[model samples]
Target: MAYCPKCKGEMPQTAAQCPHCQFDFPVESPTGEGARTGFAYSPLADFALLVSMIAATIGSVSTAIGSIVAVFHGHFFEGLFIGPIAFFLQLGMLVTFLRVTKLGEEKQ
Candidate 1:
């Protein structure tokens, strides 16, 4: 599936025009700048994606290490607490990233 670049409306991948907004798809060039294979360019979206990815990586690593260390050091109860905390942390980051993408689509 593909989305209309102008209105972000869902459509068929082979669609030449958006059925909802009647927006025409641009011709495919060698560079594919207007290709239907991906999301349209948005500076804010790019930055948010990069930052969120980095944060998620670091946060996950630390959370894992911290949880393991706590359990091994006789802090089993603390390890239990850390599990849910880390889960929420990751969930929040995911939500934030999704929100940014939605905003980017809306502003495009």
Candidate 2:
């Protein structure tokens, strides 16, 4: 799907004009050069991913430290369980976010 820049309406990828606003899309010349419609990079999503990664890193480190403290305090069960679980959960979340956004795919 593509968005109509003029009317902000959703339309099929094959559409040459916006149905809602009747805005015609620009045609490419015979040389095959025209305006590109999609984005090369989304700054907003990138920023979000950066922030999430930072948060996850901090959380994982803290969890590890907390687990060590717990072990030193003779709470081995709590130390072992909480740290790995939190770390893996954050890692899974990061993976899911990356997959959902398709951020690293090659353009072809």
Candidate 3:
């Protein structure tokens, strides 16, 4: 089974037009309103992007400031490891979220 690009309804693989929504899968009627195969950006991705941005900002600022303060206070060992580790973990999480979002949108 294949899914309609517009409505995401399952249809026969050989179907050219979606029976559920009557959207033509490949060809349009020259009016340009019925081209159903075009990719649409997911709203969920927008939310994810906002969340990731916030996470990154919080992580970076906290980590950097924490490390700097620790170093200035003469706690070199703790600052050298904990701060950068936290920042990098947040960065990795942001990248992974972005990649998953893009892949999900493309598959739609």
Best by lDDT: 3
Please identify model 2 stretches exceeding 4 Å from their true place: 1-42, 94-105
Model 1, runs deviating above 4 Å: 1-49, 102-107
Give the alpha carbon lDDT tens digit for every residue of 3-105 in model 1. 8889999998877889999998675664443442344356665776878867876786777778788889989877778665895687678777778668657
The CA lDDT at 63 in model 2 is 81
User: What's the residue-level lDDT of 69 in candidate 1?
Assistant: 87
The CA lDDT of each predicted structure is: 0.74, 0.73, 0.76
**TM-scores vs. true structure, each candidate:** 0.42, 0.47, 0.47
Scored by Cα lDDT, where does model 2 land? Answer: 0.73
RMSD of each candidate relative to the true structure: 11.3, 9.8, 10.1
Error of 1 at 23 (Å): 22
Q: What root-mean-square deviation over C-alphas does model 2 reach?
A: 9.8
Model 2: per-residue lDDT, tens digit, 1-108?
Answer: 889999899987778888899999875453232332335235776687778877876787788788889989999887888767886787777677667457354322
Each candidate's clash count: 0, 0, 0
Candidate achieving higher lDDT, 2 or 3: 3
Candidate 1 vs candidate 2: which has greater lDDT? 1
Q: After best superposition, candidate 2 residue 5: deviation in angstroms?
A: 27
